[model samples]
Target: MSGADIANVCNEAALIAARHNEESVKLHDFEQAIERVIAGLEKKNKLLSPEEKKVVAYHEAGHAICGWYLEHADPLLKVSIVPRGQGALGYAQYLPPDIFLYTTKKLMDRMTMALGGRVSEELHFSSVTSGF
Candidate 1:
């Protein structure tokens, strides 16, 4: 779906939630909505191939490894290459402790950690793959 379509759906969901006497929609509610949308999309049989799965595994591994290496970053909870209900080929789930605030350095470090996978792929494979 397009960004506009997602935005429209989110707006509608917010309206619906509000009409139900919800003071404010939480992040988890929006996340669940997104997951439902993705599940619907996957039911249409749009799944990634083996190569794509490998790339995702590598990408997620990068995130896991980076997070594992950082002291303040979240701990790696799990990493999987198996396709889930939402059609994600892979994912790196983290267990983040309470994050009250973020500093500039912390933000930059997070950004760098996210980029670790792409950088690792480029450095080792010498050929970058697009699905990431």
Candidate 2:
């Protein structure tokens, strides 16, 4: 990460810790900060129709399922259909493997994991939604 990125994380994590009345910036605070940085803040007030909500839930669940079953895919940390950042309708956080290098199989597994959401939508709804 760059110097600015590290600084941003520290500032955000400290704010999160303070909001929670913690003595120090904790690991979870850092994690939340990182997520906020990467995904933007959770947009809890965003409204979705029931049908859209169902679709988003299914899409995220598809990601979780694929990640869980794929040997080289990262393990899931959490899944949510709650709108996040500017455009994310749903997300599945994974405890990614620490290694930097990716083998061919691992790369393919990652690609499959990414496609899980759309594949799920196709399987359940019989149609794929636009965008990633």
Candidate 3:
């Protein structure tokens, strides 16, 4: 994780511990904190048009489906469409491996998953946009 990510997780873990009247952050606190940090605080107040919502939903679903079936890809944990941290309209969470080196198949699977959204848009809408 990056320095900002570590800081955010620590801060969130601390808050979680305090909320439950605990003395220190536990494993569960860190897990929840990581999820919160990655998924980001939901933009409850953000508004979207129905058409935009449909498009985003489909795009995110495409990513999830692609990751699910791609054998060499990282294990998918979650997917979300809530806008967060500036212009991030959506994201896909994966249980990444620790090692740095990657095999050719792994890279290919990653590429396939990355392109899933655009493929989906083309298949469904017959045209694509750069919003993703």
Candidate 4:
């Protein structure tokens, strides 16, 4: 990793250890630090009604479920609804292969994966959120 990346991860690890009142950081702390730095901290103060929380949960679940069934979409790593990066309410993390070229089917699979969230909202709630 680059210098800045190392610094951020170390700082986050320290924060994680401190949060747990531990004297040393662990592997999972570093892992969580990377996620925290990438996704920003969870919106602790953001108040969502029970229904809204359910929607966000289902929205994230939809992405995972749809991507899981797709043949050519990137392999999903994680999904969350902690509201990271500007207006992002949630996200799906995919592990795309390192390549410079793409096939048409791969592109379409990506499209289907991307649309999964919106489709899920429409199907479940009979309406889509403005965020999707």
Candidate 5:
């Protein structure tokens, strides 16, 4: 099965679980979904090439670093270079305990942090990819 197919299956499962009024979907379910996608990618031999992997790593690392540098930005939760069902080459996840109204400066800072990955990739590699 393709990564997208596995993701769709996971989405359907989550939807069904939610509709059934389950108290909470287990974390194991999410892990299973991720594993399925990763396995599919592996079977397809679509694992990123070395250069692409480095690009993805640096791109994700930029987001985490920039977010950490910003005063009002959330803390970095995780960063991954693995391709997911959502078709993303990488992702940088953050955790903000609370959402509060933002000042203009804060909003700009947030936007800057959000764009940090693309900017860094371009700056470092002298090129940009569709993945960005």
Candidate 6:
């Protein structure tokens, strides 16, 4: 995250805590702020068919699984199938490693991890959707 992003997250977290009538910011507040920053706002009103939900679950899981297995991939943080942003069916979050420079192998691992979702869809459904 950038310096500005960190400031925004802290500010947002405080707001969330205030909304909940808490005297001080807590882990939950920061978590929500991080999610809001990373995933945009959650669109609770966005509707998905049962099939779509199922597909999204698998697709996100694919990303999580790939990251889990890749030595150079960032550590997986959380995976969600909730509809968020304009058209994201789901997302898999990762906690990027603290490194000043990345090796070529590291970059390749990241690419492989990113493609896991599309490959997963092909494997599971025998076809790929637009995938948001």
Highest-scoring model, lDDT: 6
lDDT of each: 0.66, 0.87, 0.83, 0.84, 0.72, 0.91
Tens digits of per-residue lDDT for model 1 on 13-130?
Answer: 6865676688887675565455445433233354667767667777777878888787657677666565555445556666655777987777776777778778757765658765
lDDT of 6 by residue, 44-80 (tens): 8988999889889888988899999999999998998
For model 3, how does the per-residue alpha-carbon lDDT over 7-118 read when each residue is reduced to its tens digit? 9899999999999999989999998788778776767667878877777778878888999999999999888787765566777888898979999999999999988887
Best by TM-score: 6
Superior by TM-score: candidate 2 or candidate 6: 6
Cα-based TM-score, every candidate? 0.55, 0.80, 0.77, 0.85, 0.63, 0.91
Report lDDT (Cα) of residue 91, candidate 5: 80
Residue 69 C-alpha lDDT in model 3: 96
Clashes of 1: 0
Query: lDDT score, residue 128, model 2?
Result: 77
lDDT of 4 by residue, 49-105 (tens): 888878988888888998899898889999987777666778888888888799999
Error of 1 at 102 (Å): 0.9
lDDT of 2 by residue, 4-100 (tens): 9989999999999999999998899998898887678888788889988988998999889999999999889888787888789989998876798
Q: Superposing every Cα of model 5 onto the true structure, what RMSD results?
A: 7.9
Candidate 1 TM-score over all chains jointly: 0.55
Which of candidates 2 and 5 is the stronger one according to lDDT? 2
> What CA RMSD would candidate 1 show?
8.2
Instruction: Report model 3's TM-score to 2 decimal places.
Output: 0.77
Candidate 2 segments exceeding 4 Å error: 1-3, 20-23, 98-100
